[model samples]
Target: MAETILALEGATKRFGGVPAVRAMDLTVERGTITGFLGPNGAGKTTSLRMSLGIILPDEGRARLFGKAPNARTLDRVGFLPEERGIYKKMVAEDAVTFFGRLKGMPAGKARQRAGEMLERVGLGDARKKKIKEMSKGMAQKVQIAAALVHDPEFIILDEPFSGLDPVNQKVLESMIRAENQAGKTILFSTHVMEHAERLCDRIVLIAKGRKVFDGTVNEALGTVPRRVLIETGEGPDAAPVLAAHGAVTDDGMTGEGTHRYTLDLAPGSDAQDALKALVDAGVRLARFEPVRAHLHEAFVHLVESAEREPA
Candidate 1:
């Protein structure tokens, strides 16, 4: 219910009948970091284009701050596309400053800000060198500076970590967190779920041009069945007996008198049934508890569910 910073209503795009995005609808609230995640070929780039006003949706609409993709709205947003570009011959500092000037920042002020940002991003030493002379990580730092130099209210980054090494990745992650804390809205698209898990306040997942899931990590994972790992007495393949009323993953005895079994909760499954099952299986049950799935497990469960849906 927070004020919407970006909204797409029934937005659709196509590359000659092969739909890139199909009737997708999503909203990003002001000052929130919302993640866009998907596997390869999931239409992440096309959705980003509509969000940034580069290409109008062939069907439906995209709005930024209640206005159609126009100069005013565009000026208020920073974009780092999946495919990045920088003048290879231009020094890193000059290139970023030039982009700021195009956005109406005065040249002198732009240069000052460029210098500050380079230092902040740890590329101050390479600021005077041509982009082609720098390593991929160094060049990427310059590109991020260019995207953020204008200090736009909303930032959209597409695959910003593709070329970054681990050290650079950590550096960029810190920068992103700092900016978010400063109250800038961010919509970052990545194939990497771990990044989203670490950085986003909320998440929107798309697959094959359709939305498969949208919400917080906790909310997304809430649908998975709660599980329990129990180590008890002894039983020879207790799966069928225990699973008769629920779901069972495995069963085995550890040490003497210690039996371990993985239980999958059935719909309306009574957990007490687990202890009873083990007790009746001639195993003296010793442990009982539910284990919640991790973020990776939840993500796999959701995506697998989405794959079963009809196109």
Candidate 2:
């Protein structure tokens, strides 16, 4: 069995009599890239803070590497907070080196790693530039470099892609893949589903401060019903025929006098079967294509379902 890197049992937190997170259980296995995903204000940050022992949970407990988090254990972890900050006047390399030193790296080695990290993050030219002199995206990368310079075994990133442009986001994604390939366990929180879909080996989804789903990408995607798109020449008989195969909904018109409808295939039903049924019924087909489920769709489905449950 894979070792557990981080675990939370019945973790809960609240502020001003309002719950921020409630009875959450999560685990990240060693050597895997885990994605902590949710919308804004979904208690993701609170949960992460609790996991790192930066903030104590009001109830339950968090175990880091099978023990409570402390200076010794925390030293082996790298964290990039949702709120980014650094010495505005410190040069980029010096800023990264400062964080490395904080993590107990020797001064000379810290400086050396700082330079290498800055260069790896595409900020080598900006190494001599002060944080105040850099753009928002550039400064964010500097903080990322700092978090990673010490080469910690476990990495936790919260909202790491929030401010970057597409190009820089891609750069960060590449860095994450490279780190995991180098045998680091990673957990990152993001509202962007595409990033999680592309990078995570497993995903934990939170909504309204509670976990809604935890599983592999394929398992999550399975929550969304199988669907297919079918277009037929505005015929009254088509809707009835389509409904026999699965739940049918009218999609907006595609072209002149052509209507599009989404058919959610029933359990034990197949798209090919639906297509054949439509053909057998002599429905004039304009288009017939299977609709693939996506992580974003699954996220919405799970979250919305959770929201409707009694609190």
- TM-score versus the correct structure, for each prediction: 0.89, 0.97
Candidate 1 structure quality by residue, lDDT tens digits, 166-219: 888888899899999998999999977778888888999888898888899888
Question: Tens digits of per-residue lDDT for model 2 on 1-311?
Answer: 99999999999999988999999999999999999999889999999999999899999999999999999999999999988979999999999999999999999999999999999989998899999999999999999999998999999999999889999999999999999999999999999999999999999999999999999999999999998988888445677887878899987777577888899988888888888888888888888989899999999999999899988
lDDT assessment of candidate 1:
0.85
Clashes of each: 1, 0
Residue 290, model 2, lDDT: 92
Q: Relative to the unseen true structure, what is the C-alpha lDDT of residue 61 in candidate 1, on a scale of 0 to 100?
A: 95
In order, the Cα lDDT scores of the candidates are: 0.85, 0.93
Evaluated at residue 64, the lDDT of candidate 2 is 98
Residue 196, candidate 1: alpha-carbon lDDT: 82
